[model samples]
Target: MTIDEQQASVAVIGLGKIGLTLAAVFATNGYYIFGADKNKEVVASINQGKSHINNEPGLDQLVSDAVENNQMRATSDNVEAVAHSSIIVVIVPVLVDTANQIDYQMIDAVVEDIAKGIKKGSLVIFETTLPPGDTKNRFGKRIEERSGLRLGTDFYLAYSPERVYSNRIIEDLEKYPKVVGGINEKSLLLASTFYKQALNCQLIEVSSIETAEFSKVAECVYRDVNIALANELAQFADQTGVNISEVIVASNSQPYSHIHSPGIGVGGHCIPIYPYFFINKGLNQGLTPLAREVNDGMAAYAISQVKKEVGSLANRNVLILGLSYRENVKEPTKSTTLLLIDQLLNMNANVFVNDPLFSDREIHAFGVTPLSLQDKSISKIDIIILQAYHDDYKNLNFKDFTNCKLLFDGRNQLKQEDIKKHGITYQSIGQQSEKGEW
Candidate 1:
C-alpha cells in the first residue's frame, strides 16, 4: 500500500504512557487511530476524550482534540483494533524479573493477540525494547505461525524502539531522529515511508532489525555504566574528604569528558531495567552487573548517612520528600525512593512521606503516613531526606525546616552553606559537609 493509503488508519496496541501518546500523535497527524488496551477503564476514558496517564505536558488536550474530530477511538479488544487499521504499532513493556532475567511473557502475549486479526500487507512495528535478536527471531516467527502467513511477503515486520522518556514524550518524538529497521528491504522502505509521513521527525534506517534492537539497549546500558561510575566516585570522595561534584565539574572542562551526577539511586523504567534485557541474554562482560550492583546499593547508603547524622532513629520522625523516581513525573516505576522508605521503616524510624504530585492516600498505600508540607507537624520532624528534586521544593526557604535537625539532600538540590546557615546539619551524595562535625 502507498503512504497515503496507509495513512487512512493506524492501530496502536497497549494504551499506557507511550502507546497512548503515539496514538494521539498519529491522530493529530490526520490518521484515524484505534487504540487497544486490556484495561476497560482506560478504554472508556479515552473514548470519552479523557487521558488516563498523568504529568505528560499536553496529552489531555491532544486526546480531546483527536476524539472530538473523530480521528481517534479506543477499544479493549486487540483483534478489533487490528482489523480496523492497516498499520499496527506495538508499544507494550518488556520487564525484568526479580532474578534479573528478561521476561518475554508480555510481548509474547501481545503478538499472539495481534496475529489473530492482522491482515495481509499490514505493517507490524515493535516499539518495545528487546534483547539483540528477539524482534526478528521470536516476534517475527510468532506472527508468522499464528497468522499462517510469511513475513516480508504477506505482511511486514520491523523494529523501532521508543526512545522518549515519560514527561517529554511528544517533544522527543518530534525532536529525536527515529531509528528504524525491518526484516527485508521492502519492509524497510514501507516502514520508513509511514513514519516520515506520519510524524515530524527524521528516520535513520539501519541494516537489520537486530541492529535497531541493540541500538536502544546499548544507549541505556551506556547511561547505566556512566551513572554507576559517578556513584562509585561519590563513595571514594566521601571517604577521602574530597568534593566529588567539584571534581566532576573541573574534569568535565575537557571536551571529551561528560559525567552524570550521583543520586540516591538509579530509578525509572529505562535505565535501571533495560540493562538486564541484555545481561540476561549472556552479554554480561562484568561491567553491566557491577553497575547494577552499585546503583542498587545507593538507596541503602543514603539511609546509612541519615542514621549517621541523626545518631539514632528509634524515636525520630523522618520526612521523605518526593516519592516519584524523578522530578516532575508522577510515575514510580522502579523508583529507589520506595526502597529507602522500606529501609527507614525497618530501622524503626517514624517515616512521613510527602510529594505534591502524589496524593496523601497514594503515599499511605505504601505503608507510610503522608504529611503535607504546610502541616504543623513539619516543624517537628527530626530529619528530612530530599529524595526527589522537584521544582516546587527548589527555592524553599530555610525557615520552613528550622525544627529539623538534619537534612539529607539525596539529589544535591540544596546549597551547603545556605543549609548550614540555617543551623541544620546538611549532607549530600558527593559533597563533604562544611561543618566537619555532624
Candidate 2:
C-alpha cells in the first residue's frame, strides 16, 4: 500500500498514555484509528468518549470528536483491532520482574495476538521503549515466523519511539521531533509517511531499527545519569552546609551550561528504568559497574536523608506530601516518594500521606490514611516531609507547620524566611535552613 492508502486504518495496541495520544492525534488528522486494551472498563470508557485519567485537558473532547466522526473507537479484543487495520502499533508497558530483570511478557503476548491476525503487506511499528536490540533480537523474528509472511517484502516492521511526558502528552505531540527507523528501507519509508502526515513537527530518519532503539534508550539514559549526579551533589552539599538549588541556579546563569535541579530522587517510569536496560545489557556483553552503581544508589540515599531529618525514627508521626512521581499530575508509577514511605514504615515511623491530585482510594491502598491539610490536623504531626513541590503547596503558611518541629523539604519546597520565623528545624535539597533543636 502507498502512503495515502496506509493512512486509511491505524490500530494502537495498549491504550495507555503513548498509545491513546497517538490514536487521538492520528484520528484527528483524518485516519481511522482502532484502540485495544485488556482492561474492559478502560475500553468501555473510551468507546463512550470518556477518559480514565485526569489532569489531561481536552482528552474527552478529542475522544468525542474521533468517535462521533467514526474515526476512532476501542475494544477488548486485540484480534479485532489488528484485523481492521493495515498499520498496527504495539505500545504496552515493559516492566521489571520480581528479580529486577526485564519482563517481556506483555509485549510477547501482544505480538502473538498481532501475528495471528495481521495481513500481508501490513506495517507494524513498535512505540514501546525496550532495551537495545529488543526489536531485532526478540520480537522481530517471532512475529515474522508466526505470521508466515516474509519481512521486508510480504510484511513490514519499524520502531518509532515515543518522547513525551504524561501531563504534557498533547502539547508534546505537536512539539517534539519524531524518530523513525525500520528493519528495511520499505518499512522505514512506510512508517515515516504515516507519522509525517499526522504529526506537526520534525521527523528524522536513522540508519537502522537498532539505531533508533538505542537512540530512544540514549535519550532516557542521559536523563537518568544526570539526575543521579544531581542527587549525589545535593547530598554532598547538604553534608557541607551548602545550598545546592542556589548553586545550580547561579551556575545556570552561564549561557553554555544548564544543570537540572536536585530532588529527593528520580521518579517516573522511563528515567528510572531505561538506564537499567542499558546497564543490564552492558553487563551481559561485559562489565557495567559505574552505571549500575550510581543509579541503583539514588533511592537509598534519599531514604537516608529522610532518616536524618526525623532524628528519632520510632513512633514518629510523619506526614508525606506528594504521592505521585512528580508534581501536577496523578501518575504514580515508579514514584520515589512511595519508596521513601516504605522505608520509613520499615523503620517503624507512623506515616500519613497526602497529594492534591490523587484520590483517597489510591492513598488508602498505600496502607495510610490520607490527611487533609485544610483541617489543621497537621498540628499533631511530629514531622512534615514535602515529597512533591505542587503549586498548591508553594504559598502555604509555615505557621500551620509551627506545631511540627521538623520539616524535610524533599523537593526544596520550603522558604528560608518561613523556616526561620517558625523556628522549625528544616532540611531541603541543595539548601540549608538555620539549624535549630527540634
Candidate 3:
C-alpha cells in the first residue's frame, strides 16, 4: 500500500501506562485505535473513558474524546483488535528473573496470539524491550509460520521502543525522538511514515530490529550505570563521613561530566531491569561482571542507608510517602519503594503508606493501610520515608510531620533548609546539609 493510501487502523496490545499513552497519541493523530487487554476490568474502564492506571495527564478526557469521535475502541478479545487494525503494536512487559535472566514468555504469548489473527499485509511493531534475536526469531518467525507468509514481502515487522516517562507521558510522547528499525527497507519506510505522522519529533531509522532493540536498551543502560555510579559514590561517602551530594554538585560543574545524583534506590520498571537485560546478555556470551554488580548492589545500598538512618528498626512507625516508582504517576510495578517497605515490614516495623494515585484496594493488597497527609492518626509516626518524590510532597509544611524526628529523603524530594528548620534529622543519598541543629 502507498504511504498515504495506508489505513489508519492501529491495534495496541497491553493497555498499561505505555500502551494506553501510545494508543491515545495515535488516536489523537486521527488513527482508529483498537486497544486490547487481557483484564476485562481494564477494558471496561477504558471503554467508559476511565483510566485504571494513572500515568498520562488528561487521559480520561482523551479516551473520552477518542470514544466519542469513534477513533478509539477497547476490548478484552485480542481477535477483535487484531481483525480491526492494519497495524499492531505490542507494548507488553518483558521482566527479568530472580537470577537477572531475560524472560520473553510474555512477549512470546502476545506474539503467538497476534500471529493467529494478524492479517497478511498488516504491520507488526514490537515496542517491548527484548534481547537481540527475539524480534526475528521469536515473534517474526512465529507469525510467518502461523500465517504461511513471507516476513518482508507479505507483512512488515519492526521494533520501536517506547521512551516516554511515566511522569510526562503526553509531553514526552510529542517531544521524544523515536527510533525504528525493520527487517527490510520497505518495512522501515512504512513504519517510519506511520510514526512520523503521529509523533512531532524526529524519527531515526536504524538497520535491523536488533539494532533498534539495542538502542532502546542502550538509552536505559546509560541511566542505570550512571545511577549505579552515584549509588557507589554515596556508599563510599557515607563510610568516609563525606557529604557526597555537595561533591556531585561541585563535580557536575565541570559541564562535561555531569553525574546523576544518588537516591535511596533506583526504582521504576525500566531503569533497574533494562541494565540487567544487557548484563545477562553479556554474561551469557562471557563478558564483564562490573555493570550487574554495581546496579544490583544499588537497591540494597539504598535500603541499607534507610536502615542506618532510622537507627532502630524494631517497632518503629515508618510512613513510606510514595509507592509508585517515580513521581506524578500511579504505578507501583517493579518499584523499589515497595521493596524497601517489604524489607521494613519483614523486620517488624509498623509501615503506613500513602500514595495519592493508588487506591485503598491496592494498599490492602500489600497488607498495609493507606493514610492521607491529613490523617489524624499518623501524627505520631516515628519515621517518614520519602521514597517517590511527587509534587505534593515537595512543598509540604514542616508541621505535617512535626511528631516525626527521623526523615529519610530517598529521592531528595525536600529542600535542605526545610528539613533542617523542622528540627528533623534528615539523611539522603549523596546530599549534603548545612551546619545546623539536628
Q: How many residue pairs clash per model?
A: 0, 2, 1
Model 1 per-residue lDDT tens digits across residues 96-198: 8778688888778889988999998899999998888898789988899999989889999999999998788999999999999999999998889888877
Show the lowest summed lDDT stretch of 10 residues, model 3. Answer: 283-292
Better of 1 and 3 by lDDT: 1
Q: How close is candidate 3 to the true structure, as a TM-score?
A: 0.90
Pairwise TM-score winner, candidates 2 and 3: 2
Candidate 2 per-residue C-alpha lDDT over 194-250 given as tens digits, one digit per residue, 9 for 90 to 100:
888867668989998998898988887677666667777887897788878878888
Please provide, for model 3 over 394-415, each residue's C-alpha lDDT reduced to its tens digit, 9 standing for 90 to 100. 7787576767867777776587
In candidate 2, which residue ranges exceed 4 Å CA deviation?
1-4, 283-303, 306-310, 436-438
Q: Quote the positional error of residue 150 for candidate 2 in Å.
A: 1.0
Total clashes for model 1: 0
RMSD of 1: 1.8
Distance from true location, Cα of 243 in model 1, Å: 2.1
Model 3 alpha-carbon miss at residue 313, Å: 1.8
